[model samples]
Target chain A: MKELKILAVIAALVGITYYGIEPYAHSVMHPEVSAADFTFKDAKNVDTSLAGNVENGKVLVEANCIACHAIEKAGHPALMPNADAAASYGVVPPDLSHAGRIYDKNYLANFIFDPVSAMHLSHKYPVGGTKAFPMPSYNWMTPQEIMDVVSYLQSVAPKVTEDKEGHKATFEAACGRCHSMAYAKFDATTPKDSIKAYMGATPPDLSQYIKSRGEHYLHSFINDPQVLLKNTSMPRVGLNEKAQEEVIAYMEEIGDSKKAERESLGLWVMLYTFVFAILAYLWKRKIWSEVH
Target chain B: MAEFKQADSMYEWFDQRLGIDKFVKVMMTEYWIPKNINFLWAMGVLLTVMFTLLVVSGIFLLMYYKPDINMAFDSVNYTIMQEVAYGWLFRHIHAVGASVVFLIIYIHMFTGIYYGSYKRGREMIWISGMLLFMLFSAEGFSGYMLPWGQMSYWAAYVITEIFGGIPLIGGDLVVWIRGNFYVADATLTRFFMLHVLLIPLAILGAIVFHFYALRFPHVNNEAGEFFDFDEEAEKYLAGDKKNSKVVPFWPVFLSKDFFVLGFFLLFFFYLVFFHYGFAMDPINFDKADGLKTPSHIYPEWYFLWSYEVLRGWFFEIAGISGKSLGLMAFGFANIIFLLLPWLDRSPMVKPANQRPYFKYWFWLMIADLMVLTEFGKLPPTGPNAWVGFGASLVFLILFIALPFITKAEAKKVGGK
Candidate 1:
């Protein structure tokens, strides 16, 4: 009875602390937020009626975008190199090679119309403000012209296959502008100092982000940066659901490549230990039978 | 001697030269243990198994582990966990072993205290065990620095900075320990040396001393019954085993021990396989960046109680700053475990259950420490700070009032 009492006391103390209080404390400290809406509902709707002329769209992109953004797959080299552009604009503009494949169509069209307003970064780069945005608004152009540019980007973009290498390509195009993948030997296109000035903190390398932020967090955070952390400098990359998963997959490929192997081997290791434990129990019982 | 008479077989030849039979007789077969002990007594064997597991797993980790700050995180997280076959298994085993070893150590330590195992001639057993505990803590802390993750870097930064709270030589002491003003490459390399080498060697030596210390007083029983082991061994050997109060260490005592070890392994591997996230913190997955600090920083679960004591003092007392007082309290909390033998002042030899006041004191101590541990991981604000302060005060009062209570009990029993 005394032993039972001691055991009861221990159980109560440990149980209350871990199961009862610890979880309560954690819940209080880190209250749950609603999951991020993957649908870009707030983004401007695309008007499907506006038919884009591919030939005309290519001419417009060459005239307007090629000066800043490179469309290398379309055979148009960037007019200014990254070093010069970063020096002037305080951020290197991303290459438009995979923009149409990775980005949401509506978001891409809206972003082309007004960069600051589309990203809700008007607070940082208000109109006529000293700290104006690097990307000039193309709001003066008609909606048809903006859709044509988006259509041109889609025409030039390569189809990303749905595998590790394909995911790597998507990840590189989507996040590699600012984030480096050290494991993959992929350096960020933007210079460190330029990005640091652009985004307050130096963007963390994404090599181990899969393990760090985890899948669900990365999903919500990537879907909408402001949802998880308010006032975060990260602009929502506006990747569609499929492209986001691909990026996360590529992260898992590099960061936790052995997850499958580790999981399978865990079963076997547990089984072996279980068998050994039973055998040990039997051996112990057999030896003790001669004692009394 | 009869077993060593003839060299007819290889075993006999070895026995003749090395006295293996005699050694086994002295260490195992002829050694007696009380039969009244519970499964908690099995914790000693469980701790030994944990230590052995940790050492074996640590060796495997050391093979591919890089001590350099730049490469250390990748070497462990990427190279070993991803590229090397079965490296993740070894890493998981090592990480889980380092954590579970402390669980077993606490159970073992508490079992000693509950049964008054440190009393009479058993001081060295408790003393040596305490030494092993401290050594294992240092080993854990040093090993925690090797991964060079965000938590690893920050934890090292916070812990090493504690030494700077000392009086005059505090500033130099922190630098001397870190080998730099900050937790840099030098600190990681030196900690790697200590974790993988120095502290483990100390623990091994301490284990030998602990086991040897047990030879003088023998293992304490659950009911704290004193036994004449030599006579008991004779009784069992002379075919009156059922009447013997003691059992041989080899088969009888170890049989029960093995049974407990079986259950422990089931639980241990269950954690390693299915629930290893508790052992490996998610925040530690990010590489170390000294410029940015994590929003919340806390030590591992095992050190939470003492850490809470360190953070418990929120106000200045007289001339000393709260930080200095907190540091002193933290040191006191850790060092007080070593003085358990002298502080109890009890003439009683039985377990806490048999002593009225001592039993409540033991339970209160357990509850208070648990409170401290729970409050430790929380942010020091408002209610958490107050609760932590109350627990810390209880902890101090419990220790300070121990001698008085135990001595009063001794007087009630008409003993010294």
Candidate 2:
């Protein structure tokens, strides 16, 4: 009875600390927030009746986008080199080769229409802010023109197969310009200093983010950085849901690839240990039988 | 000693030269252990088993583990976990073993205190065990740095900074210990050596001392009864096994030990396989960035209570700063258990249940430690700070009051 009482005390103390207090503390420290909505509701809508013309879109991209941006898959390189572009724009602009596959359509349209407001970056570039936003908004383009540009980009974009290569390609296109995957031996394409100046801080290496921030948090944070962290330098990446899933999958593959192996092996280890425990208990009982 | 003439077999040849049979008799078969002791006494054996697991797993980890700051994080996370075969299993076992070994150590310690095993002749055993505890704590702290992650970097940074609280040479002491102004490459390499080599060897030596100390007083029983080992072991070896309170260590005592070990392994491996998240902090997954510190940082669970004791002294008393006072209190809290043999002056040999005040004291100590550990993890702000401060003060007051309370209890026991 006394031993049982002592056990109860220990169990109670351990339980209250681990289960009760720890969770309570964690809840306070990391208060849960709803995932960011990726509806892109407020963006100016493209008229669905007018079908996009890829040829017109190509003409438009050459006229408007080529001076500053690149569509390497479409054989139009940026007029300015990466070093000059980084110096000028504060970061090397991403190549538009996989933009259509990676970004949500509505989000991309909105981003082009109003680069400042679309990325939830109004706080960074205020009406009377000292520095101008790097990318100029193409507000004059009609809805049909915008749709055509989107279509052209999509047509030239390499098809992203649902596999490790696809995920890696998507991640590199979307995030690798700014964030490095150090574990995968992938470095950010843009110079670190330029990125620091552009984003107000260099983006963290994404190697172990899956383990640290976890899947749900990553989803919310990537969908809209400002929602979780007020005025975070990180812009909304505007990855489509599928693209987002792929990015997260790639992160997990890099960071926690052994998770499946660990889980599968756990069951076998548990079974073996359980059988051993049962046998040991029986043997203990048998040995004690002689003494008793 | 002079009777052996020729080798009967390979084993006998070795035995003739090595006294293997005599060694087994002294250590196991003829060695006596109390039969009346319960499963709580099994904690010592469980601790040994866990130590062996840690060492075996640690050896595997050491094969691929890099000490350099540039490669350490990748060596652990990428090379070990992803590249090497079954490396994750070994890492999980080592990580979880390091954490769970403390749990068994705490249980063993509390069991000793509850039964007053440290009260009289068992002082050396208790002291040697405390020495091992200190070594294990050092081992855990140093080993944590091998991952080169956010928590590891900051924990080493924060703990090493604690030395700056010392007077006169304090500032230099910190830099000296780190071998630099900060916990950088030099610090990491030295801690790597300590974790992998120095502290482990010290711990092995201390374990030998602890077991050697145990051999003298033998093991105390559940009822805190003292019996002559030779007398009871004779009864046990004769036909009066049922009447004897002692049994031989090898077959009879080891059967129970192995049984308890089975259940312990079940719980331990369950942690190593499934519930290992608690042992490995998520923040630690992030590679260490000296430029960017995490928003919140705390030590591992085992050190939380003492850590809280340091943090709890939140305000300056007189001219002495809270940091200095905290550092002293933290040091005191860590080593206070070593003084337990002399602190409780009560002559009573029975368990805490037989002593009125000591029972409440023991339970209260357990509860206070839990509170300290819990609050230690939370941000030291507002109510958390006050609660921790109160608990820490209570912790000190309890130890301070021990001699007086036990002295009065001793008088009463003597009167009875």
Candidate 3:
């Protein structure tokens, strides 16, 4: 009986010690986000809030999209497919902040309402762009949700004048052959001529340019033009400082504004630390115990 | 024949009243089992109970476990989280039990060494134990991959590929085992079968033989003094002999064993309940994508010393390629234990009676193993590789030099 009691006491002590250290071991080994600080406002505009939701949209943006898009104030795109690469294959998510000013509200509405039409040049928007990316269309979204996203974009979109000069230069250099450049207006009368008239070579029609290039290709071209059309006569025009601003402004005439991506470093660190701690504790308790 | 029947009846009568008091008195008065059996002697009993737990829990898990890569992880999760009542508890206990078994076995082996349990008539036991260690390692490696998690997939890949270092047939051997260039569903299935059935069966057989051989010579008690009992004392020890305190096995050793087992089981349960399960990740929960390597890849902790040895070889010979040296060093480290029975030639097995030279070597070997295990856990970084390599060399020197040094000391002492 005495022996049994001693045994029970030892067992109890071990059990208590294990229980005490368990959370710490788990914390160090498998850190996960416990706070409601990060969430995705899905296509339905449902506010999926994380614990602490302290930074509002900031943390969510980082966790979900920052890997591909620049979100944090200091974060840069680590794997942004360049314009040439994007245009060649046509799979890319464009910068959203300045998109509201580029495309007409109606065009933006149609594209967001159905990304497939944006993805493929359908008969309705027939221009048949070469680039192809299976950009998942969010058909599940409500019109109200889409409008909320547009509103978010409109609030943060860069000022219109910041990119006017580059648009004018591009219009003069490429679109000047067939259209008038007054108030950034085009003639819309020139025939689809041979490949030798616009900028020393006749290019594809501008009316179907968005449909042909697609959102991804267009974004990449605006970001870095040389990447898309190699030795082609599409002179790398809007890529320069003044031209880039203006061209982006011109493009916004055709694109919808969207929220910038966010990057959450705190969550990643927490997770890494948790996993490390658990492994260390287990290893120490089991294998390393043999040593001491 | 009548006397035998009377003795059998007497044993049956004694069994009915089994308890600690009667058992202890009998052992003291009859069995002649050295009263000096210490903490070290308790390990054998501990190991036996631990093995029983391992086998029982393992069998329960095996009944529901699917070894195929596709179902392995899911089956484990289902068994623990949903299927059998308290299934999760059982699985975690078994998983953690493996670690505990290894822990106790290591202790058992070390204790054997400290008491010269490997010397003379004990060579067979020592050799069998070493084989058991090898089987345990194989069991661990095979079971580790069953979960098909990130660490499991990668560790299995890296460790199995060590065979590729062989001159001619290495690649083929690896491929045959894997059934593909990489470890996948087939490999998991095969390993699962081996882990759940074949290796375990072999381990059980080996353990029986180990004990059978052990009983032939009886156990080496703490005093390290070999004794020959007279017929009267032997009979008393066996409960038929007079002037011996022969305790019934039941409620005597049985009760003590249960107490120890209870303590261990409590520790095991505490880890399982509070920690949310053993540390191994459910590898199959995440889909295996070859392109994305897990951030950190390491074998389970038990294999860390050999891992460290392999890594240490990289920096040992500066001009030589790190790959070859690393392989050789790891191979050498693993096989070193196998050579132990032949290495030391001390006439005395007890630590207290062993020559100082032999003691120095024994302690150094222990230190070397500890260092290797430590080095294994660390990431291959800046000066760690060099440190591991340098330490390994020192250990190797100590290991080889110890025998010769002991022999020289013995010659000097004899001359004096």
Best by TM-score: 2
Per-residue CA lDDT of candidate 1, range B295-376, in tens? Answer: 8888888888999999999899998888988998998999998999999898788889788678999989988988898899
Question: Chain B TM-score in candidate 1, rounded to 2 decimals?
Answer: 0.98
Query: Which candidate has the highest lDDT of all?
Result: 2
TM-score of every candidate's chain A: 0.87, 0.90, 0.32
lDDT of 1 at A6: 60
Query: How high is the lDDT of residue A216 in model 3?
Result: 43
Cα lDDT of model 3 by residue, B105-144, tens digit: 8767887887878877888888888989999999989888
Q: What is the per-residue lDDT of model 2 for residues A1-292, given as tens digits with 9 covering 90 to 100?
A: 8757866877776678777345677787788887566666665555534678999999998899988888889997776867788898888888999998888888887788788887888888887899778888887999889888888888999997888898999899989889999878898888888888888887889988998888978989889888788988788878888889999999998888898999899989888988988888899898888778
What is candidate 2's lDDT per residue for B152-199, written digit by digit as tens? Answer: 999999999998988899999999989999999999999999998999
Task: Give the DockQ (2 decimals) of all models.
Answer: 0.50, 0.61, 0.02
Candidate structures ordered by DockQ, highest first: 2, 1, 3
The best candidate in terms of DockQ: 2
Q: Between candidates 1 and 3, name the one with more favorable TM-score.
A: 1
Q: For residue B164, what is the lDDT in candidate 1?
A: 96
lDDT of model 2 at position A258: 90
Q: If ranked by TM-score, best first, what sequence of candidates would result?
A: 2, 1, 3
For residue A174, give model 1's deviation from the true position in Å: 0.8
The sequence of per-residue lDDT tens digits that candidate 1 reaches over residues A173-279 is: 89987888888888888888888988888888988888888797898888877777787788877888889999999999998887887678778877887887788
